[model samples]
Target: MARIKETFDSRAWFMLECDDPDCERRFDDGQWYAYEDDLLADAKDDGWQILYRDEHPELERDMQYCPAHRLPECSTCTNIMADPAGWKDGQCPECIKEEIPNERS
Candidate 1:
């Protein structure tokens, strides 16, 4: 196939692009999948980076990423870092010392 329904978790469906220059596959598994937070967590676990892209405003899917890349943004505070070292364990330094926000938020 052309398309198949897949999920990072069994719940929500998250689309991820293959960052490999030769690959660059855009995943469009459809929205029937649920539990996006789980997918986000799974992406972090897999060392994927979430990058902001408006290339497809017509599709309304601005946030996209490559599984091979990792942006140093705090998943909790949503603050992006100039230095990738600023993030630790999927969080900013301050967030590492603080509690994780609601997963569903």
Candidate 2:
């Protein structure tokens, strides 16, 4: 099946699928799914299907590794860059460290 609702974390540069009810209405399941392809395999083993893999076309333009976002926490951080120049792009060294909304101008 096609994805239900997907969103850009707006910084980390991955497409988040909002399909699973277990993911706290966000992509929480995928958040901890980093590099653990085994988890994905296990899901398949357990009879779960991968309906779709959501991703940003823009990010693939540079062929970078698109990681899952922290979701509801670190998605909008200005610092989720793949390059050392990430800081220059308004992102912090770690994308999880964004300024609070009220703290910003």
Candidate 3:
């Protein structure tokens, strides 16, 4: 969970943090907003990314990643991997391994 959502005095307060476990970047508007869209706009203005699901374009992503670690998700399995070497033909190593035949047939 990169963003913290809190309600105070009938208003919303947001504090964003980098999703990467190694990165320690954070953002706080320090002001209450009337609507979620307002806070989201501010978050984007500050370079925070709002990732979405590749398979389901209508569904918004639950997790947020910083500019540095905004890795691509595997097409077969929606997993965000840091190492590019794990990707081949837009699929992760594990997914590719699963496709391989167990025995030479």
Give a tens-digit lDDT track for model 2, residues 2-87.
22233445322232343333443433345443333443454445444343223323242322111232212223453223334434
Write the residue-wise lDDT of candidate 3 on 4-101 in tens digits: 77888867767766776877766554565566677667777877766546733544555666667666767767665555586777777987788942
Model 2 root-mean-square deviation: 15.1
Per-residue lDDT value at 61 in model 1: 35
Per-residue alpha-carbon lDDT of candidate 1 for residues 1-105, written as tens digits (9 for 90 to 100): 111346554443445555435655554334333555565556567665554434323333335445544445667777765345756666777776677663534
Best by TM-score: 3
Local distance difference test values of all predictions, in order: 0.52, 0.34, 0.65
Residue 96 local lDDT, model 2:
23
The better-scoring model by TM-score among 1 and 3 is 3
**Candidate ordering by TM-score (highest first):** 3, 1, 2
Q: Tell me the TM-score of each prediction against the true structure.
A: 0.32, 0.22, 0.49
In model 1, the clashing pairs are: 11-34, 12-34, 12-35
Runs with alpha carbons beyond 4 Å of true place in candidate 1: 1-12, 18-32, 52-62, 71-105
Candidate RMSDs in Å, in order, are 11.1, 15.1, 8.0
